[model samples]
Target: MKTDILKFQNLNPEKETQISNLFKQLGGEKKQIPLKEVLEEGNHITLAYCEHNDQVVGIASMCAYHVISGKKGWIEDVVVDEQFRGQGIGRKLMEKLLEEGKKKKLTEILLFTEAHRIPAIKLYGDLGFKLKESRIYTLKMP
Candidate 1:
């Protein structure tokens, strides 16, 4: 599989559409967000892969933030097409994110996967992430 990492600015219309379609196929309620939102947010990066036939087989995103200790990034929305899993595409996406974070001088990159997502957890650990012993709390708004 041919894979490449592209910044939002470098994404063409076809690639953008591919990304939107991929998100929906992965069960995202929404299709696509405006490019302006991505840029204005200033910390999020989207990575995509294109196969030889020009189909996007994978997509991943990360949001970076600054804290007192240092800059940190959070991985989000990682998805590989069901047909394309187990080909190392997901790992490539993560490698791209890590490289981007390093380029931006981030001190850490964090991610969370559900307990049932054992494959994802293993992938993260193989990429040098450790499971935090601390508890996580969430508050949903109406």
Candidate 2:
């Protein structure tokens, strides 16, 4: 059966729960934000999700913002269900998000992934993302 990818702005309760579970696959010990907050981050964020048989099987998100460099987008939290991996759902969701970025006329789109996530890195590279030279640092806020 074919899966459908849609923008995840307004979601019903059942599909919301399914999408929450799907997000857990990406973050092992990372606490999930409440589903309401997840979907309500801001108008700058665009989320794309794919569902199979009414169950959300994949999700990808991008945030577009204007900075000194110009309008840019940052892709984040892209994941596909284990069973659905390699079926092109992730790519389609990303394509949808990139389409959104183009519609907004973003100057550049950036994303970060651990070197250990080889398949994901490959996918990003195949989608025309380059390995950037800058080192990333994060500080946890309490």
Candidate 3:
């Protein structure tokens, strides 16, 4: 499968649609991200995706931030179409994210995946991510 990584300058309507579809595959529901959010560039966000035959088959995104400690990259929303899994597309997406991290000079990269996602956990491990002994807490506002 051919994996064409998208350049920010090349983003357009059609490609955005493909990306939204890929996110649906990840979230298991139709919750389209606004173009405004997807287009956040500079130090805030960078997105990477693999396109095959006019369709986005895999995608990953990162948020770059600078705390008092150091600059960091947080990986998020990684997903590959079920039919396209095991073809190294997910790996490619991750490599793209890491490559971006390097370009951004991030001090560290972090990601969180569900414990049940065994394959994803293994992939993250193979990519040199260690299991950090920490708890994730969340709160929703009404």
Q: What is the lDDT of every predicted structure here? A: 0.77, 0.82, 0.82
Ranking by TM-score: 2, 3, 1
Give the TM-score of each candidate: 0.82, 0.89, 0.88
The regions of model 2 sitting more than 4 angstroms off are 1-9
User: What does candidate 2 score in Cα RMSD to the true structure?
Assistant: 2.1
Q: Model 1: runs farther than 4 Å from truth?
A: 28-32, 39-43, 46-52
lDDT of 1 by residue, 35-141 (tens): 54664535466554545478888888888888998899988778888888888888988888888898889998888777887778889999999988888787755
- Candidate 1's displacement at residue 52, Å, is 4.2
Clash count per candidate: 0, 0, 0
lDDT per residue for candidate 2 within 67-124, as digits (tens), equals 9989999998899999999898988888888888999999999999987999888888
As a whole number from 0 to 100, the lDDT of residue 102 in candidate 3 is 95
**lDDT (tens digit, per residue) of candidate 3 on 19-123:** 777788876533666755666565477777787777778888888899999999999899898889998888988998898899889999999998889999999
What does each candidate score in C-alpha RMSD?
Answer: 2.5, 2.1, 2.1
Name every residue pair that clashes in candidate 1: none
